[model samples]
Target chain A: SQTIHQWPATLVQPVGSPLSLECTVEGTSNPNLYWYRQAAGRGLQLLFYSVGIGQISSEVPQNLSASRPQDRQFILSSKKLLLSDSGFYLCAWSVLRSEAFFGQGTRLTVV
Target chain B: DQQVKQNSPSLSVQEGRISILNCDYTNSMFDYFLWYKKYPAEGPTFLISISSIKDKNEDGRFTVFLNKSAKHLSLHIVPSQPGDSAVYFCAARRVYGGSQGNLIFGKGTKLSVKP
Candidate 1:
């Protein structure tokens, strides 16, 4: 079975601070990875996705960025956090255009 | 513009009754549709899916129906239970020309099934 893991279940950070959220998948290789953010009472917005290592595609222009360092490791980062950057961050993986599997999200609050 | 839309923000249902959730989309190129369930503070889970080629798909107590002509889809849960209370999201994927090549989601509908 394939499983995704994301860290820092909840965090409180000051404005202009750096951010780093890591995600990894086990039991699968070369799967598609995606990063999404959901504001309170809003739909999820796709931030980034990677089909392979060292490749990343961004959807909405934002203060965040994503990177896939290894086949199954993806990282979402930001040099400086904004108040608007606070939200629920989810990591997902899919294979061959199939359904996606998600990890327990990271709740980030920028104060 | 929002490609996928779930107009209903919330729903209430009685236990043992059927729960039907509706979704509509504006894009004609979307070939795949899916429904996901989410609990508070947790990630959304894949519940069911239906391809454009098929009008319906069933899994256990869940069934997904797609109407390509109207660009509408629906999820039905039979014998709704209290555990079914949660936020439900509708998502769509176009086989081609999707930005970031990812699934697009709609604002979820919170379903509360009371016993």
Candidate 2:
């Protein structure tokens, strides 16, 4: 069975602070990884997706960025956080043309 | 423009009754549709999916129906229980072409099944 791990579960940071959220999958290799954010009263918005290492496709342009350093390790980062950047961030992994499995999302609060 | 749309923001149902959640998509190229369930502060979980070729797919108490002509899909949960209370999201994807694994999601409908 494959499992995705994301941390920290909840984060509180000041404005203009750096952000780093990590997600990793076990029991699968070369899986497709994605980063999604759900703002208040909104749906999950795709931020970035990677089919392979060092290859990332961004959907919405914002302050956030994603990187797949290892085959199963993906990281979402930001140089400076904005008040609008606060949301529920989720990490998911899937095989080609299949349903995606998600991690326990991170609730980020930028004050 | 939102490719996927869930018109209902919330729904209330009684236990042991039927719960119907609806979704519509504007893109004709989407060939795969899925339903996901989510609780507050948690990630959405894959509940069920139906391909464009098939009109209906059932898994246990959950059933997903797709109407390609109308570009619509729905999720039905019979004998609804309190545990079924959560936000449900509809997602669609174009399986062909270069966007095989990308999924577009809706705003989700909050379902509350009371006992």
Candidate 3:
């Protein structure tokens, strides 16, 4: 079975601190990966998506970026966290033309 | 502008009654639509989907209706139960290539099924 893992489940960082959130998938190859962020009581916003290693498409421009270093590893990073950057970050994977499977999600609080 | 829109931010329904959630889209290229259910603090789960070619699709008590001409879609849950309380999101598949694409999601509606 395919599974996605997102680390740190929760994080609290002061404003201007660096941020790194990791997500990985197992039991699949060359799957499409995506990053989404949801504000409290709001809909999700697409952050970035990657179809293959070293290829990324950013949806909403912001203070964040994504990189797929390996086939199944995707990392979301921010050089300096901002107060507006606090939200729930989710990592998802899917096959061609299929529904996505999501990780548990990480809740980041920028204090 | 947001391609997909869900105007209602929240809804309240009594248990054993019916609950309806609505969504609208602006893109005509969207041929496939889906509904996802998300609990608090958890990732959204796939609930149901309907293709543009089909007017409706149903899974048990859950049904999705698509009105392609109006660019609108809706999800209906009959005999709504307490377990049905969650956030419902509407998504449209954006196909970039033959095998590469992703879904564009609406703002989502929070359903409160009260006992």
Candidate 4:
């Protein structure tokens, strides 16, 4: 069974502060990883995706960036958080099967 | 330009009745369509999907139908239960890309099942 793990289930960050969210997958290798954001009671918006290590494709331009350090480890980061950055962030993984599996998600609030 | 659209913002249905959620897209190049169920404060889960080659696909009590000509798709949940009440998102994907099959999601519809 494949599973995804994300840290800091909830967080409160002051404006202009740095941000770092980590995601790791187990029981699978070389799987594609993605980062998505959802506003309150809305759908997901793709931010970035990676097909392999050190390779990332961004969908929407934002204050955030993503990296794939290892085969199953993905990280979303920002140098300084903005008020608009507050939202629900989700990480996912998929492969040839094409079914995306999501993480528990991190609820971030910028004050 | 919203490529994917779930026109309904919310829906209510009696428990044990059928719940039909509709979705429409603007692009015909989209070859794969999917439905995802999301709960509050959690990530979205993969519910079901249908390829362009097939009009329908069924899994358990959930069925997905795709109409390429009309650029529409739907998800039907039979005997809707309280557990089925959540935000459903319609997603589409293409087979060719570094992001192959990486879904482009719709705005979503909230389904409420009343007992």
Candidate 5:
């Protein structure tokens, strides 16, 4: 069974502080990974996606970026956090099928 | 321009009653559509999906209907339960090269099943 894990389930950082959120998948190899942010729980805005290690794609231009250093590891980072950047961040992975399985997610609050 | 649109911001239905959520898209290239259910403080979960070729697909009490000509789709939940209270999102994807390359999502509709 494959499982997705994210760290620091909740975090609070001051504005202008740096940010790093990590995601990893177990029991799967060579899967497509994605990063998403949700505000008000209405809809998810795609932040980034990785097809393979070292290959990352940005969906919505923002103050954030993604890096996939390992086959199952994806990291979302921001050099300087902004107030608008506060939201629920999610990491998801899928293989062959289009339906995605998401991680527990990280609730980030930029004060 | 929003490719997919879920006009309803929220809905309330009595428990055990039927719940219907509607979605419309403007893109014709979208051949595959999906509906996702999201609970508070949790990531959206894949609920149901329907291909353009098919008009309807069902799993237990959850059913998805697609109308290509109208460029619209909907999710229907029979015997709506309190557990079904959550936000519902509609998404579309254009399939090519044997897979959906990317997906476009719409603003979700919050459903409340009153017990």
Candidate 6:
């Protein structure tokens, strides 16, 4: 069975600090990876998605960026955090035109 | 513009009753629809899905119905239990577009099934 792992279940950081959230999938190769954020009282918003290594498509322009370093390893990063950057971040993986599997999300609080 | 919309922000139901959650999409190109359940502080879990070719799909206690003409879909949970209390999100995907695997989610409806 395939499973996704995301680190730092909860994070508290100061403004202008750097951010790094990692996500990895096991039991699958060359799967599509995505990053989504849910702001307070809002739905899941797609931030970025990657079909392969070093290929990323961003949906919304903001303070965050995503990278796919390996076939199953994805990272979401930010050079400087903003107060508006706080939200629930989720990592998901899926095969071509299939339903996605999600990892435990990270709750980021930028103060 | 929001491609997917869940009009209801919350719902209350009694145990053993059926829970029906509705969703609508504005994009005609979306060929796949899905439903997900989520608890606070956790990621959404895939519950059921229906393709445009099929109007309905069932899995255990969950059933998803799609109306392509109306660009709408619904999820029905039979014999709703207390454990069914959570937020339900509706998602749609365009298979032929460049964002094939990318899902567009609607604002979730919080369901509360009381015993």
Candidate 5: C-alpha RMSD to true structure equals 1.5
Global Cα lDDT for candidate 1: 0.93
Return the top candidate by TM-score: 2
For this target, which candidate reaches the highest DockQ against the unseen true structure? 2
Cα lDDT tens digits, model 6, A57-111, are 9999999999998999999999999999999999999998899999999999999
- Give the C-alpha miss distance for residue B21 in model 2, angstroms: 0.1
Residues B1-114 of candidate 6 have per-residue lDDT tens digits of: 999999999999999999999999999989989999999999999999988999999999999999899988999999899999999999999877675558999999999999
- A4-84: candidate 4 lDDT, tens digit per residue: 999889999999999999999999999999999998755799999998999999998989999999999999999999999
Q: Could you give the DockQ of candidate 2?
A: 0.83
**Cα RMSD to the true fold for all candidates:** 1.4, 0.8, 1.3, 1.3, 1.5, 1.0
Candidate 1 backbone clash number? 0
Expressed as tens digits, the lDDT of each residue in B1-115 for candidate 1 is 9999999999999999999999999999899899999999999999999889999999999999999999999999998999999999999997655543479999989999999
Q: Grade the docking of candidate 4.
A: medium
B5-47 in candidate 5: lDDT tens per residue?
Answer: 9999899999999999999999898888889898877878889
Instruction: Rank by lDDT, highest first.
Output: 2, 6, 1, 3, 4, 5
| CAPRI grade of model 1 | medium
How are the candidates ranked when ordered by DockQ, highest leading? Answer: 2, 6, 3, 4, 1, 5
Summarize candidate 3's per-residue lDDT along A1-111 as a digit string, tens digits. 899999989999999999999999999999999999999756889899999999999998899999999999999999999999999999999987788888989999999
Error of 1 at A31 (Å): 0.9
Clashing pairs in 4: none
Candidate 6 lDDT at A84 equals 99
Candidates in order, TM-scores: namely 0.96, 0.98, 0.97, 0.96, 0.95, 0.98
Worst 10 residues of 5 chain A by lDDT: A95-104
Using DockQ as the yardstick, the better of models 2 and 3 is 2
Q: How much is B99 displaced in model 6, in angstroms? A: 4.4
Each predicted complex: what DockQ? 0.69, 0.83, 0.75, 0.72, 0.58, 0.81
